[model samples]
Target: MKLSLFLVSTAGLWVAANANSVNNKQTKNDVCTHPFVDINGRCLFVNNFAQMDWDAARAFCAGFQGDLVTLDEANLLADIVDFIYKEGLTDRSYWIGGSAGAQTGAFVWPDGSLVRMGTPCWGVLDNIQRPGAEPNEKCIALNKDNFFFFDNFNCEGEISVICEYKFQRENRWAEGGCATMKSSAVFVFLAAALLGSDGATEAGSHVKTDVCTHPFVDINGRCLFVNNFAQMDWDAARDFCAGFQGDLVTLDEANLLADIVEFISKEGLTERSYWIGGSDRALEGEWTWTDGSSVRMGTPTWGANGQNQQPTGGSEENCVGLDNANFFFFNDFPCVTAMSLICELKL
Candidate 1:
């Protein structure tokens, strides 16, 4: 009688443990139905209110607990349009992850996934072609004039931003590999958790942690300078700076100019006039950016007739070159001077 009673107790305990395990599995499966926040089955709405560069916008989204807008699934497009209308984003344009930044032909999202947008679909019937249109390049923007519409803007242009959160991928294991060894070894070496894609190690499979690094780094994390140029034309310099995840430096304030001056002074780039984008080539006496935006020469950081000098008698200071001392005025340096210009991109 005693032996039979012990056997019954052991069997009952085993059944209860198994039942609990089954219930836990069902709960985990049910939770997988929701992708992420504000997103119903892989759709989300994001609205922007500030003008920023493509890179700047991406950074904003990452901080918003989301990644830069990626047009992958069909529902995402519809959600974005609805958000734009609801939020009344008719002030200016915004940027999405359609640009080939820092690299070309390889367009990837902030998460390093390939860009995948469905057939060209715009909310409005605007004749303007977006990034995927004929003669298309990778770069999309939210246009304000055409509310609920998108167009292809230059990747370097500053605009507002939006982002969407994505779900972490579920990992799995394959057969006939080193996965078996990892599982058995986990108990033996319990000091450290050997992390793998699906909690199992396999040959030729690399497990990666979700670590994000900034593309641009500086000594003080404020101003970034690219100081590697021998002799390239202004156009070539601009291209080189853009390639470095930045553009020819634009000075919006005196402090920004001071930062550049400090950077140049530290680098000992004296006696060389670097090319900047402050050329009045298209319009005389009226400064404009390469992207064709009005530039207000806020304050003179130079002596009288410093940047105001039209050396070429063309009625415009087409190119800018740095001089010594607190005089931060730019002269009409020839485009072919090949001086190293500064490139400042949004982080």
Candidate 2:
């Protein structure tokens, strides 16, 4: 009878262990579902059920406790594009978190970070178009038709959306219904638990460090030097930057421009015009950066109105300078015209 009791007890223990294993597996699976796909440690949801305008699409993502996906890294964006292609979505455009806001051409993420422009971030001619002669395209979308290269579109235009939320290990639970919990609240709790009271990492925590040379301020992962020493013409300014193993600053992204503006304001240099690295000297009406990338013209890049507007001097003005007269909006000026300069170097 004792032997029989021992066998039954062992059987019960085994069954309990099996049930626990099954519960754990189910909890893992429940962390993500349907539209939400696990990608590079983040949970991303592609919503194609309804087409909505940019504002509406943003609201929809917010309702799910997520925001429109912001692609700061090129590799991350490529991964998302690949995921979309694998899912057989090759004909739809999905709204992302980039927009020019009140100032056109200065594209920024929803969180106010600069969206890297040109090359891999933007689609080729076939995939992206400016829509009209005017600078009215304020919103950005991922074009599946063009391999998911980002394209600027009208904000009012209806389109699908992609939402993103961070995935935390502690949030996974079989019986806690964590999937229905608000993402913001989960993030707060997780951050507190992981970071602890001191807000410093514990011993053996991995950290990343970056350093910049003297006189060059680190701005959004880039080293920038605003030359306050002297004012010179565009050609001389280019030579000045070349001396320091850099080039005249290229305001390719909106946030970069905003940072420069803020810096100027802080330094009391609001009235000084600065020479930037954009010119149409090679081909009239075709503005290109020092790196030979074509410039996305209009709106924030140009002055808001009146005589301060861009390319105002026509062929006579071949170089671009950030004019303080019109709140630092770029204006085409003669290459020989004297102005302060801004330089940039990659970290």
Q: Pairs clashing in candidate 1?
A: 52-159, 98-138
Highest TM-score model number? 2
Every candidate's lDDT: 0.43, 0.60
The clash tally of candidate 2 reads: 0
| Predicted candidate 2 versus true structure: per-residue lDDT over 22-116, tens digit per residue | 01223344444434555544556676657899999888877767788776654456455655655555567999888885755577777665665
Residue-level lDDT of model 1, residues 66-105, one tens digit each, is 5665554323343444445434554656676555545555
Error of 2 at 50 (Å): 12
User: What are the models' TM-scores?
Assistant: 0.33, 0.44
